[model samples]
Target: MSNQTSVTEFLLLGVTDIQELNPILFVIFFTIYFVNITGNGAILMIVILASRLSFCGPNHVHHFFCDIKPLLDLACGNTELNLWLLNTVTGTIALTPFFLTFLSYFYIITYLFLKTHSCTMLHKALSTCASHFMVVILLYVPVLFTYIRPASGSSLDQDRIIAIMYSVVTPALNPLIYTLRNKEVRNALNRKVRRWL
Candidate 1:
Protein backbone atom coordinates (compact mmCIF):
# COMPACT_ATOMS: atom_id res chain seq x y z
CA MET A 1 0.00 0.00 0.00
CA SER A 2 1.36 3.42 -0.99
CA ASN A 3 0.63 6.46 1.18
CA GLN A 4 1.19 9.00 -1.58
CA THR A 5 -1.21 11.59 -2.84
CA SER A 6 -0.76 13.49 -6.06
CA VAL A 7 -1.04 17.28 -6.05
CA THR A 8 -1.64 19.08 -9.30
CA GLU A 9 -1.61 22.76 -10.11
CA PHE A 10 -4.89 24.21 -11.27
CA LEU A 11 -5.14 25.18 -14.89
CA LEU A 12 -7.33 28.11 -15.91
CA LEU A 13 -9.75 27.00 -18.60
CA GLY A 14 -10.70 30.43 -19.85
CA VAL A 15 -13.66 30.13 -22.20
CA THR A 16 -12.23 27.72 -24.76
CA ASP A 17 -15.34 25.65 -25.40
CA ILE A 18 -16.19 26.71 -28.93
CA GLN A 19 -13.22 26.46 -31.28
CA GLU A 20 -14.85 28.92 -33.68
CA LEU A 21 -15.08 31.51 -30.88
CA ASN A 22 -11.35 31.55 -30.18
CA PRO A 23 -10.59 34.58 -32.29
CA ILE A 24 -13.57 36.49 -30.97
CA LEU A 25 -12.70 35.55 -27.41
CA PHE A 26 -9.11 36.54 -27.98
CA VAL A 27 -10.14 39.93 -29.33
CA ILE A 28 -12.59 40.51 -26.49
CA PHE A 29 -10.17 39.48 -23.74
CA PHE A 30 -7.30 41.34 -25.34
CA THR A 31 -9.38 44.50 -25.28
CA ILE A 32 -10.37 43.84 -21.68
CA TYR A 33 -6.75 43.26 -20.63
CA PHE A 34 -5.74 46.50 -22.25
CA VAL A 35 -8.56 48.42 -20.58
CA ASN A 36 -7.96 46.95 -17.13
CA ILE A 37 -4.24 47.63 -17.20
CA THR A 38 -4.58 51.10 -18.62
CA GLY A 39 -7.50 52.10 -16.41
CA ASN A 40 -6.01 50.92 -13.11
CA GLY A 41 -2.58 52.17 -14.10
CA ALA A 42 -3.99 55.58 -14.89
CA ILE A 43 -5.83 55.81 -11.56
CA LEU A 44 -2.68 54.78 -9.66
CA MET A 45 -0.65 57.30 -11.61
CA ILE A 46 -3.10 60.09 -10.87
CA VAL A 47 -3.03 59.23 -7.19
CA ILE A 48 0.73 59.27 -7.17
CA LEU A 49 0.95 62.51 -9.10
CA ALA A 50 -1.59 64.45 -7.05
CA SER A 51 -0.13 65.57 -3.74
CA ARG A 52 -3.63 66.28 -2.48
CA LEU A 53 -4.69 62.68 -2.89
CA SER A 54 -5.21 61.56 0.68
CA PHE A 55 -5.21 58.15 2.29
CA CYS A 56 -4.95 56.99 5.87
CA GLY A 57 -1.26 56.13 5.68
CA PRO A 58 1.46 54.41 3.69
CA ASN A 59 1.44 50.59 3.67
CA HIS A 60 4.07 48.33 2.15
CA VAL A 61 2.60 45.49 0.09
CA HIS A 62 4.58 42.22 -0.32
CA HIS A 63 2.97 40.23 -3.09
CA PHE A 64 4.74 39.21 -6.29
CA PHE A 65 1.82 40.10 -8.51
CA CYS A 66 0.48 43.65 -8.52
CA ASP A 67 -3.21 42.72 -8.58
CA ILE A 68 -3.17 40.73 -5.28
CA LYS A 69 -3.70 37.11 -4.17
CA PRO A 70 -4.06 34.84 -7.20
CA LEU A 71 -0.30 34.20 -7.29
CA LEU A 72 -0.59 32.11 -4.13
CA ASP A 73 -2.41 29.44 -6.13
CA LEU A 74 0.73 29.13 -8.26
CA ALA A 75 2.96 27.96 -5.41
CA CYS A 76 4.68 24.67 -6.29
CA GLY A 77 4.92 22.91 -2.92
CA ASN A 78 3.06 23.03 0.39
CA THR A 79 0.92 26.11 0.12
CA GLU A 80 0.29 26.71 3.80
CA LEU A 81 2.62 29.66 4.12
CA ASN A 82 1.56 31.01 0.75
CA LEU A 83 -2.08 30.67 1.69
CA TRP A 84 -1.54 32.45 4.99
CA LEU A 85 0.31 35.25 3.30
CA LEU A 86 -2.33 35.51 0.63
CA ASN A 87 -5.10 35.70 3.19
CA THR A 88 -3.39 38.47 5.12
CA VAL A 89 -2.51 40.43 2.00
CA THR A 90 -5.81 39.92 0.30
CA GLY A 91 -7.78 40.71 3.44
CA THR A 92 -6.03 44.03 3.85
CA ILE A 93 -6.42 44.82 0.17
CA ALA A 94 -10.10 43.97 0.31
CA LEU A 95 -10.99 45.77 3.53
CA THR A 96 -8.85 48.89 3.33
CA PRO A 97 -10.42 50.22 0.15
CA PHE A 98 -13.89 49.81 1.58
CA PHE A 99 -12.93 51.42 4.85
CA LEU A 100 -11.31 54.34 3.15
CA THR A 101 -14.30 54.81 0.94
CA PHE A 102 -16.56 54.84 3.95
CA LEU A 103 -14.29 57.27 5.74
CA SER A 104 -14.23 59.57 2.73
CA TYR A 105 -18.00 59.70 2.65
CA PHE A 106 -18.14 60.13 6.40
CA TYR A 107 -15.90 63.17 6.19
CA ILE A 108 -17.83 64.51 3.25
CA ILE A 109 -21.03 64.23 5.26
CA THR A 110 -19.45 65.74 8.32
CA TYR A 111 -18.03 68.57 6.31
CA LEU A 112 -21.37 69.19 4.71
CA PHE A 113 -23.21 69.26 8.00
CA LEU A 114 -20.56 71.11 9.98
CA LYS A 115 -18.65 73.56 7.87
CA THR A 116 -19.80 75.93 5.06
CA HIS A 117 -23.31 74.52 5.59
CA SER A 118 -23.96 74.41 1.90
CA CYS A 119 -26.13 71.64 0.51
CA THR A 120 -24.84 72.05 -3.03
CA MET A 121 -21.15 71.40 -2.27
CA LEU A 122 -22.10 68.54 0.00
CA HIS A 123 -24.26 67.02 -2.69
CA LYS A 124 -21.49 67.30 -5.25
CA ALA A 125 -18.92 65.74 -2.94
CA LEU A 126 -21.30 63.00 -1.96
CA SER A 127 -22.13 62.26 -5.56
CA THR A 128 -18.48 62.14 -6.58
CA CYS A 129 -17.27 60.03 -3.65
CA ALA A 130 -20.29 57.73 -3.81
CA SER A 131 -19.68 56.88 -7.43
CA HIS A 132 -16.00 56.15 -6.87
CA PHE A 133 -16.72 54.20 -3.71
CA MET A 134 -19.38 52.12 -5.42
CA VAL A 135 -16.95 51.15 -8.15
CA VAL A 136 -14.25 50.26 -5.64
CA ILE A 137 -16.63 48.18 -3.57
CA LEU A 138 -17.87 46.37 -6.64
CA LEU A 139 -14.31 45.61 -7.79
CA TYR A 140 -13.00 44.39 -4.41
CA VAL A 141 -15.95 42.51 -2.92
CA PRO A 142 -16.00 39.79 -5.59
CA VAL A 143 -12.23 39.33 -5.23
CA LEU A 144 -12.58 38.94 -1.46
CA PHE A 145 -15.45 36.51 -1.90
CA THR A 146 -13.53 34.35 -4.35
CA TYR A 147 -10.14 34.31 -2.59
CA ILE A 148 -10.30 35.11 1.12
CA ARG A 149 -12.40 32.20 2.34
CA PRO A 150 -11.20 28.62 2.69
CA ALA A 151 -11.10 26.77 -0.58
CA SER A 152 -13.71 24.08 -0.97
CA GLY A 153 -14.65 21.57 -3.65
CA SER A 154 -16.32 24.11 -5.86
CA SER A 155 -16.94 24.07 -9.59
CA LEU A 156 -14.80 26.20 -11.91
CA ASP A 157 -17.87 28.08 -13.07
CA GLN A 158 -18.07 29.98 -9.79
CA ASP A 159 -14.42 31.00 -9.98
CA ARG A 160 -14.74 31.96 -13.65
CA ILE A 161 -17.74 34.17 -12.94
CA ILE A 162 -15.94 35.92 -10.10
CA ALA A 163 -12.82 36.49 -12.19
CA ILE A 164 -14.91 37.96 -14.97
CA MET A 165 -16.70 40.25 -12.53
CA TYR A 166 -13.53 41.71 -11.07
CA SER A 167 -11.49 41.88 -14.24
CA VAL A 168 -13.79 42.61 -17.17
CA VAL A 169 -16.96 44.10 -15.74
CA THR A 170 -15.24 46.32 -13.18
CA PRO A 171 -12.80 47.73 -15.70
CA ALA A 172 -15.52 48.38 -18.22
CA LEU A 173 -17.59 50.24 -15.64
CA ASN A 174 -14.76 52.36 -14.16
CA PRO A 175 -14.31 54.80 -17.02
CA LEU A 176 -18.03 55.24 -17.40
CA ILE A 177 -18.55 55.85 -13.67
CA TYR A 178 -15.74 58.37 -13.38
CA THR A 179 -16.69 60.20 -16.54
CA LEU A 180 -20.38 60.38 -15.82
CA ARG A 181 -20.11 61.38 -12.18
CA ASN A 182 -17.38 63.99 -12.20
CA LYS A 183 -18.38 67.27 -13.85
CA GLU A 184 -14.85 68.66 -13.78
CA VAL A 185 -13.44 65.63 -15.53
CA ARG A 186 -16.25 65.65 -18.05
CA ASN A 187 -15.67 69.31 -18.83
CA ALA A 188 -11.92 68.80 -19.08
CA LEU A 189 -12.44 65.94 -21.51
CA ASN A 190 -14.76 68.06 -23.59
CA ARG A 191 -12.24 70.86 -23.66
CA LYS A 192 -9.47 68.49 -24.64
CA VAL A 193 -11.56 67.05 -27.43
CA ARG A 194 -12.43 70.51 -28.71
CA ARG A 195 -8.75 71.50 -28.64
CA TRP A 196 -7.83 68.36 -30.54
CA LEU A 197 -10.51 68.95 -33.14
Candidate 2:
Protein backbone atom coordinates (compact mmCIF):
# COMPACT_ATOMS: atom_id res chain seq x y z
CA MET A 1 0.00 0.00 0.00
CA SER A 2 3.06 2.27 0.03
CA ASN A 3 5.65 3.28 -2.53
CA GLN A 4 8.52 2.12 -0.28
CA THR A 5 7.04 -1.34 0.32
CA SER A 6 6.07 -3.47 -2.68
CA VAL A 7 3.07 -5.76 -2.53
CA THR A 8 3.92 -9.32 -3.54
CA GLU A 9 0.48 -10.40 -4.82
CA PHE A 10 -2.91 -8.80 -5.03
CA LEU A 11 -5.99 -10.69 -3.98
CA LEU A 12 -8.74 -11.06 -6.56
CA LEU A 13 -11.90 -10.76 -4.45
CA GLY A 14 -14.12 -12.09 -7.23
CA VAL A 15 -17.70 -12.59 -6.06
CA THR A 16 -16.73 -14.44 -2.91
CA ASP A 17 -19.18 -12.66 -0.58
CA ILE A 18 -22.21 -14.49 -1.87
CA GLN A 19 -21.66 -17.65 0.11
CA GLU A 20 -24.89 -19.38 -0.86
CA LEU A 21 -24.57 -18.43 -4.51
CA ASN A 22 -20.95 -19.56 -4.74
CA PRO A 23 -21.90 -22.87 -6.25
CA ILE A 24 -24.04 -21.24 -8.89
CA LEU A 25 -21.40 -18.61 -9.48
CA PHE A 26 -18.75 -21.28 -9.77
CA VAL A 27 -20.77 -23.16 -12.35
CA ILE A 28 -21.49 -19.99 -14.34
CA PHE A 29 -17.92 -18.78 -14.26
CA PHE A 30 -16.48 -22.24 -14.88
CA THR A 31 -18.66 -22.58 -17.96
CA ILE A 32 -17.57 -19.13 -19.12
CA TYR A 33 -13.93 -20.00 -18.43
CA PHE A 34 -14.10 -23.08 -20.61
CA VAL A 35 -15.93 -21.18 -23.34
CA ASN A 36 -13.41 -18.36 -23.28
CA ILE A 37 -10.42 -20.69 -23.51
CA THR A 38 -11.96 -22.94 -26.15
CA GLY A 39 -13.52 -20.21 -28.27
CA ASN A 40 -10.43 -17.99 -28.42
CA GLY A 41 -8.21 -21.04 -28.78
CA ALA A 42 -10.35 -22.21 -31.67
CA ILE A 43 -10.14 -18.87 -33.42
CA LEU A 44 -6.38 -18.67 -32.87
CA MET A 45 -5.98 -22.25 -34.06
CA ILE A 46 -8.00 -21.70 -37.23
CA VAL A 47 -6.19 -18.48 -37.97
CA ILE A 48 -2.83 -20.14 -37.42
CA LEU A 49 -3.53 -23.22 -39.53
CA ALA A 50 -5.55 -21.75 -42.39
CA SER A 51 -2.92 -20.69 -44.93
CA ARG A 52 -5.44 -18.59 -46.85
CA LEU A 53 -6.80 -16.75 -43.80
CA SER A 54 -6.12 -13.14 -44.69
CA PHE A 55 -7.16 -10.79 -41.94
CA CYS A 56 -4.33 -9.34 -39.91
CA GLY A 57 -0.80 -10.74 -40.34
CA PRO A 58 0.67 -13.41 -38.06
CA ASN A 59 1.44 -12.59 -34.40
CA HIS A 60 1.66 -15.20 -31.64
CA VAL A 61 0.26 -13.69 -28.41
CA HIS A 62 2.33 -13.86 -25.17
CA HIS A 63 -0.33 -13.25 -22.51
CA PHE A 64 -1.46 -15.88 -20.02
CA PHE A 65 -5.01 -14.61 -20.17
CA CYS A 66 -7.06 -14.13 -23.34
CA ASP A 67 -6.52 -10.39 -22.94
CA ILE A 68 -3.21 -9.33 -21.37
CA LYS A 69 -3.86 -5.93 -19.84
CA PRO A 70 -5.49 -7.04 -16.60
CA LEU A 71 -2.72 -9.46 -15.77
CA LEU A 72 -0.33 -6.52 -15.67
CA ASP A 73 -2.30 -4.95 -12.82
CA LEU A 74 -2.29 -8.16 -10.79
CA ALA A 75 1.48 -8.35 -10.79
CA CYS A 76 2.60 -7.11 -7.36
CA GLY A 77 6.35 -7.16 -7.92
CA ASN A 78 8.33 -4.67 -9.99
CA THR A 79 5.89 -4.23 -12.87
CA GLU A 80 7.91 -1.90 -15.00
CA LEU A 81 9.04 -4.62 -17.38
CA ASN A 82 5.69 -6.39 -17.42
CA LEU A 83 3.90 -3.12 -17.91
CA TRP A 84 6.11 -2.17 -20.83
CA LEU A 85 5.87 -5.57 -22.46
CA LEU A 86 2.10 -5.73 -21.99
CA ASN A 87 1.54 -2.24 -23.30
CA THR A 88 3.60 -2.87 -26.39
CA VAL A 89 2.14 -6.29 -27.12
CA THR A 90 -1.52 -5.91 -26.14
CA GLY A 91 -1.68 -2.35 -27.43
CA THR A 92 -0.55 -3.57 -30.84
CA ILE A 93 -2.98 -6.48 -30.79
CA ALA A 94 -5.88 -4.23 -29.83
CA LEU A 95 -5.15 -1.45 -32.29
CA THR A 96 -3.84 -3.36 -35.31
CA PRO A 97 -7.11 -5.19 -35.94
CA PHE A 98 -9.09 -2.01 -35.47
CA PHE A 99 -6.95 -0.17 -38.02
CA LEU A 100 -7.10 -3.04 -40.49
CA THR A 101 -10.86 -3.26 -40.14
CA PHE A 102 -11.11 0.50 -40.63
CA LEU A 103 -8.92 0.41 -43.76
CA SER A 104 -10.88 -2.52 -45.15
CA TYR A 105 -14.08 -0.51 -44.84
CA PHE A 106 -12.43 2.60 -46.21
CA TYR A 107 -11.53 0.72 -49.38
CA ILE A 108 -14.93 -0.93 -49.49
CA ILE A 109 -16.60 2.49 -49.30
CA THR A 110 -14.27 3.94 -51.92
CA TYR A 111 -15.00 1.06 -54.23
CA LEU A 112 -18.72 1.41 -53.66
CA PHE A 113 -18.68 5.10 -54.59
CA LEU A 114 -15.99 5.19 -57.28
CA LYS A 115 -15.45 1.73 -58.74
CA THR A 116 -17.29 -1.35 -60.07
CA HIS A 117 -18.88 -2.43 -56.81
CA SER A 118 -21.75 -4.73 -56.04
CA CYS A 119 -24.12 -3.85 -53.23
CA THR A 120 -24.21 -7.50 -52.17
CA MET A 121 -20.44 -7.70 -51.68
CA LEU A 122 -20.33 -4.36 -49.88
CA HIS A 123 -23.14 -5.37 -47.54
CA LYS A 124 -21.63 -8.75 -46.77
CA ALA A 125 -18.19 -7.33 -46.05
CA LEU A 126 -19.59 -4.50 -43.96
CA SER A 127 -21.76 -6.79 -41.90
CA THR A 128 -18.96 -9.26 -41.26
CA CYS A 129 -16.32 -6.66 -40.42
CA ALA A 130 -18.69 -4.51 -38.43
CA SER A 131 -19.55 -7.42 -36.18
CA HIS A 132 -15.87 -8.13 -35.68
CA PHE A 133 -15.14 -4.46 -35.01
CA MET A 134 -17.91 -4.30 -32.45
CA VAL A 135 -16.47 -7.28 -30.61
CA VAL A 136 -12.96 -5.85 -30.75
CA ILE A 137 -14.09 -2.47 -29.44
CA LEU A 138 -16.04 -4.08 -26.64
CA LEU A 139 -13.08 -6.21 -25.65
CA TYR A 140 -10.26 -3.66 -25.91
CA VAL A 141 -11.70 -0.29 -24.89
CA PRO A 142 -12.16 -1.24 -21.22
CA VAL A 143 -8.79 -2.94 -21.24
CA LEU A 144 -7.11 0.20 -22.57
CA PHE A 145 -8.97 2.35 -20.09
CA THR A 146 -8.03 0.11 -17.19
CA TYR A 147 -4.41 -0.56 -18.12
CA ILE A 148 -3.11 2.50 -20.00
CA ARG A 149 -3.66 4.81 -17.08
CA PRO A 150 -1.41 4.76 -13.99
CA ALA A 151 -2.90 2.88 -11.09
CA SER A 152 -4.61 5.34 -8.76
CA GLY A 153 -5.99 2.75 -6.41
CA SER A 154 -6.91 -0.91 -6.78
CA SER A 155 -10.62 -1.70 -6.83
CA LEU A 156 -11.54 -5.37 -6.99
CA ASP A 157 -15.09 -4.63 -8.18
CA GLN A 158 -13.91 -2.61 -11.15
CA ASP A 159 -11.44 -5.30 -12.11
CA ARG A 160 -14.10 -7.99 -11.84
CA ILE A 161 -16.52 -6.21 -14.16
CA ILE A 162 -13.82 -5.47 -16.71
CA ALA A 163 -12.62 -9.06 -16.58
CA ILE A 164 -16.20 -10.27 -17.13
CA MET A 165 -16.64 -7.96 -20.08
CA TYR A 166 -13.48 -9.10 -21.84
CA SER A 167 -13.51 -12.79 -20.94
CA VAL A 168 -17.19 -13.71 -20.82
CA VAL A 169 -19.13 -11.17 -22.83
CA THR A 170 -16.66 -11.02 -25.69
CA PRO A 171 -16.44 -14.77 -26.14
CA ALA A 172 -20.22 -15.22 -25.93
CA LEU A 173 -20.74 -12.44 -28.46
CA ASN A 174 -18.28 -13.86 -31.01
CA PRO A 175 -20.30 -16.94 -31.83
CA LEU A 176 -23.61 -15.11 -31.57
CA ILE A 177 -22.54 -12.31 -33.88
CA TYR A 178 -21.08 -14.66 -36.47
CA THR A 179 -24.11 -16.95 -36.32
CA LEU A 180 -26.59 -14.10 -36.62
CA ARG A 181 -24.84 -12.01 -39.25
CA ASN A 182 -23.18 -14.69 -41.36
CA LYS A 183 -25.34 -16.92 -43.51
CA GLU A 184 -22.48 -19.26 -44.30
CA VAL A 185 -21.56 -19.81 -40.66
CA ARG A 186 -25.17 -20.33 -39.73
CA ASN A 187 -25.69 -22.84 -42.53
CA ALA A 188 -22.51 -24.65 -41.57
CA LEU A 189 -23.60 -24.79 -37.95
CA ASN A 190 -26.99 -26.10 -38.96
CA ARG A 191 -25.48 -28.76 -41.16
CA LYS A 192 -23.15 -29.86 -38.41
CA VAL A 193 -26.00 -30.00 -35.90
CA ARG A 194 -28.13 -32.00 -38.29
CA ARG A 195 -25.31 -34.42 -38.96
CA TRP A 196 -24.80 -34.92 -35.23
CA LEU A 197 -28.52 -35.54 -34.78
Candidate 3:
Protein backbone atom coordinates (compact mmCIF):
# COMPACT_ATOMS: atom_id res chain seq x y z
CA MET A 1 0.00 0.00 0.00
CA SER A 2 1.15 3.56 -0.73
CA ASN A 3 1.60 5.95 2.20
CA GLN A 4 -0.19 9.31 2.12
CA THR A 5 -0.14 12.27 4.50
CA SER A 6 -2.51 15.18 5.03
CA VAL A 7 -1.69 18.54 3.45
CA THR A 8 -0.35 21.20 5.80
CA GLU A 9 -1.57 24.24 3.83
CA PHE A 10 -5.20 24.96 3.02
CA LEU A 11 -6.80 27.85 1.16
CA LEU A 12 -10.05 29.49 2.32
CA LEU A 13 -12.26 29.88 -0.77
CA GLY A 14 -15.09 32.04 -2.23
CA VAL A 15 -13.61 35.34 -1.00
CA THR A 16 -11.88 36.69 -4.15
CA ASP A 17 -13.80 35.59 -7.21
CA ILE A 18 -14.18 38.81 -9.27
CA GLN A 19 -10.97 40.75 -9.96
CA GLU A 20 -12.54 44.22 -10.37
CA LEU A 21 -14.45 44.11 -7.07
CA ASN A 22 -11.28 43.40 -5.09
CA PRO A 23 -10.67 46.96 -3.91
CA ILE A 24 -14.32 47.50 -3.03
CA LEU A 25 -14.36 44.28 -1.00
CA PHE A 26 -11.07 45.24 0.62
CA VAL A 27 -12.45 48.62 1.67
CA ILE A 28 -15.61 47.07 3.11
CA PHE A 29 -13.69 44.41 5.01
CA PHE A 30 -11.12 46.96 6.19
CA THR A 31 -13.82 49.19 7.61
CA ILE A 32 -15.41 46.25 9.39
CA TYR A 33 -12.05 45.07 10.74
CA PHE A 34 -11.18 48.53 11.98
CA VAL A 35 -14.55 49.01 13.69
CA ASN A 36 -14.36 45.57 15.29
CA ILE A 37 -10.90 46.30 16.68
CA THR A 38 -11.80 49.77 17.92
CA GLY A 39 -14.96 48.62 19.68
CA ASN A 40 -13.43 45.55 21.33
CA GLY A 41 -10.23 47.43 22.10
CA ALA A 42 -12.25 50.08 23.93
CA ILE A 43 -13.95 47.40 26.00
CA LEU A 44 -10.65 45.67 26.71
CA MET A 45 -9.08 48.93 27.80
CA ILE A 46 -12.03 49.65 30.08
CA VAL A 47 -11.81 46.20 31.66
CA ILE A 48 -8.05 46.39 32.14
CA LEU A 49 -8.18 49.94 33.42
CA ALA A 50 -11.07 49.23 35.79
CA SER A 51 -10.09 45.71 36.85
CA ARG A 52 -6.95 43.58 37.17
CA LEU A 53 -6.99 41.88 33.74
CA SER A 54 -3.47 41.56 32.33
CA PHE A 55 -1.73 39.78 29.47
CA CYS A 56 1.89 39.10 28.45
CA GLY A 57 2.31 36.56 25.72
CA PRO A 58 4.03 35.23 22.62
CA ASN A 59 2.20 37.71 20.44
CA HIS A 60 1.06 36.23 17.14
CA VAL A 61 -2.68 35.79 16.73
CA HIS A 62 -4.06 33.24 14.20
CA HIS A 63 -7.64 34.41 13.85
CA PHE A 64 -8.90 37.72 12.42
CA PHE A 65 -9.03 39.06 15.99
CA CYS A 66 -7.11 38.54 19.20
CA ASP A 67 -9.29 35.85 20.76
CA ILE A 68 -8.19 32.98 23.02
CA LYS A 69 -8.51 29.95 20.74
CA PRO A 70 -6.89 31.69 17.79
CA LEU A 71 -3.92 32.88 19.85
CA LEU A 72 -3.47 29.36 21.17
CA ASP A 73 -3.58 27.99 17.63
CA LEU A 74 -0.73 30.33 16.58
CA ALA A 75 1.62 29.25 19.34
CA CYS A 76 4.80 27.49 18.17
CA GLY A 77 6.29 24.30 19.69
CA ASN A 78 4.35 22.16 22.18
CA THR A 79 1.11 23.91 23.29
CA GLU A 80 1.31 22.72 26.89
CA LEU A 81 2.25 26.14 28.25
CA ASN A 82 -0.43 27.76 26.14
CA LEU A 83 -3.05 25.27 27.27
CA TRP A 84 -2.01 25.79 30.88
CA LEU A 85 -2.44 29.52 30.48
CA LEU A 86 -5.81 28.99 28.83
CA ASN A 87 -6.92 26.68 31.66
CA THR A 88 -5.67 28.86 34.48
CA VAL A 89 -4.98 32.49 33.58
CA THR A 90 -7.37 32.95 30.66
CA GLY A 91 -10.09 30.88 32.29
CA THR A 92 -10.01 33.01 35.45
CA ILE A 93 -10.11 36.25 33.49
CA ALA A 94 -13.05 35.06 31.40
CA LEU A 95 -15.12 33.39 34.13
CA THR A 96 -14.76 36.04 36.86
CA PRO A 97 -17.47 38.29 35.40
CA PHE A 98 -19.80 35.34 34.88
CA PHE A 99 -19.34 34.20 38.48
CA LEU A 100 -19.91 37.69 39.80
CA THR A 101 -23.06 38.09 37.71
CA PHE A 102 -24.42 34.83 39.08
CA LEU A 103 -23.52 35.79 42.64
CA SER A 104 -25.28 39.15 42.35
CA TYR A 105 -28.40 37.57 40.90
CA PHE A 106 -28.43 34.99 43.67
CA TYR A 107 -28.45 37.79 46.22
CA ILE A 108 -31.20 39.61 44.37
CA ILE A 109 -33.41 36.54 44.19
CA THR A 110 -32.78 35.70 47.83
CA TYR A 111 -33.73 39.21 48.88
CA LEU A 112 -36.82 39.17 46.73
CA PHE A 113 -37.90 35.86 48.26
CA LEU A 114 -37.28 36.77 51.87
CA LYS A 115 -38.09 40.49 52.01
CA THR A 116 -40.73 41.10 49.36
CA HIS A 117 -44.27 39.80 49.41
CA SER A 118 -45.38 41.95 46.44
CA CYS A 119 -45.48 39.92 43.22
CA THR A 120 -45.33 43.16 41.19
CA MET A 121 -41.95 44.18 42.64
CA LEU A 122 -40.51 40.69 42.26
CA HIS A 123 -41.65 40.54 38.62
CA LYS A 124 -40.17 43.96 37.88
CA ALA A 125 -36.79 43.05 39.34
CA LEU A 126 -36.70 39.71 37.55
CA SER A 127 -37.79 41.33 34.27
CA THR A 128 -34.87 43.73 34.29
CA CYS A 129 -32.43 40.89 34.84
CA ALA A 130 -34.12 38.72 32.20
CA SER A 131 -32.84 40.80 29.30
CA HIS A 132 -29.28 40.81 30.64
CA PHE A 133 -29.54 37.08 31.39
CA MET A 134 -30.69 36.33 27.85
CA VAL A 135 -27.75 38.25 26.42
CA VAL A 136 -25.32 36.40 28.69
CA ILE A 137 -26.77 33.04 27.61
CA LEU A 138 -26.64 33.98 23.93
CA LEU A 139 -22.96 34.88 24.22
CA TYR A 140 -21.63 32.26 26.62
CA VAL A 141 -23.32 29.08 25.35
CA PRO A 142 -21.89 29.23 21.83
CA VAL A 143 -18.49 30.38 23.11
CA LEU A 144 -18.30 27.55 25.65
CA PHE A 145 -19.28 25.04 22.98
CA THR A 146 -16.74 26.39 20.50
CA TYR A 147 -13.70 26.66 22.77
CA ILE A 148 -13.97 24.32 25.73
CA ARG A 149 -12.85 21.19 23.95
CA PRO A 150 -9.99 19.38 22.25
CA ALA A 151 -8.86 21.36 19.20
CA SER A 152 -8.44 19.82 15.78
CA GLY A 153 -8.66 20.68 12.06
CA SER A 154 -11.65 18.45 11.35
CA SER A 155 -14.34 20.89 12.58
CA LEU A 156 -13.10 24.27 11.40
CA ASP A 157 -16.25 25.20 9.48
CA GLN A 158 -18.51 24.22 12.37
CA ASP A 159 -16.33 26.17 14.76
CA ARG A 160 -16.44 29.23 12.50
CA ILE A 161 -20.24 29.09 12.34
CA ILE A 162 -20.50 28.83 16.14
CA ALA A 163 -18.00 31.66 16.51
CA ILE A 164 -20.17 33.80 14.23
CA MET A 165 -23.19 33.11 16.46
CA TYR A 166 -21.66 34.84 19.47
CA SER A 167 -19.31 37.29 17.74
CA VAL A 168 -21.66 38.55 15.05
CA VAL A 169 -25.23 37.35 15.50
CA THR A 170 -25.51 37.84 19.23
CA PRO A 171 -24.03 41.33 19.15
CA ALA A 172 -26.30 42.28 16.27
CA LEU A 173 -29.35 41.14 18.20
CA ASN A 174 -28.33 42.69 21.53
CA PRO A 175 -29.33 46.26 20.65
CA LEU A 176 -32.63 45.12 19.24
CA ILE A 177 -33.36 43.17 22.40
CA TYR A 178 -32.41 46.09 24.62
CA THR A 179 -34.31 48.67 22.60
CA LEU A 180 -37.44 46.57 22.53
CA ARG A 181 -37.28 45.80 26.25
CA ASN A 182 -35.85 49.03 27.64
CA LYS A 183 -38.17 51.98 28.14
CA GLU A 184 -35.30 54.48 28.56
CA VAL A 185 -33.75 53.65 25.16
CA ARG A 186 -37.13 53.77 23.45
CA ASN A 187 -37.96 57.12 25.05
CA ALA A 188 -34.58 58.61 24.08
CA LEU A 189 -35.04 57.42 20.48
CA ASN A 190 -38.54 58.87 20.35
CA ARG A 191 -37.29 62.18 21.76
CA LYS A 192 -34.55 62.38 19.10
CA VAL A 193 -37.06 61.71 16.30
CA ARG A 194 -39.44 64.33 17.68
CA ARG A 195 -36.59 66.87 17.83
CA TRP A 196 -35.61 66.21 14.18
CA LEU A 197 -39.23 66.44 13.08
| Models, CA RMSD each | 23.0, 23.2, 21.3
Error of 3 at 160 (Å): 1.3
lDDT value for model 3: 0.67
The Cα RMSD of model 1 versus the native structure comes to: 23.0
Which pairs, if any, clash in model 3? Answer: none
Candidate 1 residue-wise lDDT, 101-185, digit = tens: 7787788777777885677887877787788788877887887787677755433456667777887889999888877766798
| Residue pairs with backbone atoms closer than 3 Å in model 2 (clashes) | none
For all predicted structures, in order, the TM-scores are 0.48, 0.44, 0.53
Per-residue C-alpha lDDT of model 2 across residues 1-197, encoded as one tens digit per residue: 64785445433335477678878877887897986786576555433433232224225333334444344343334555545544454555567666787787788767766764787876876676688778777777777765655555645566667767777888888778767776788889889999999
Q: Which regions of candidate 2 deviate over 4 angstroms?
A: 1-85, 116-121, 182-197
Q: On a 0 to 1 TM-score scale, where does candidate 1 land against the true structure?
A: 0.48
Error of 1 at 140 (Å): 1.5
Candidate 1, residue 109: the lDDT equals 73
Per-residue lDDT value at 15 in model 1: 49
Specify the highest-lDDT model's number. 3
Worst 10 residues of 1 by lDDT: 61-70
Clashes of 2: 0
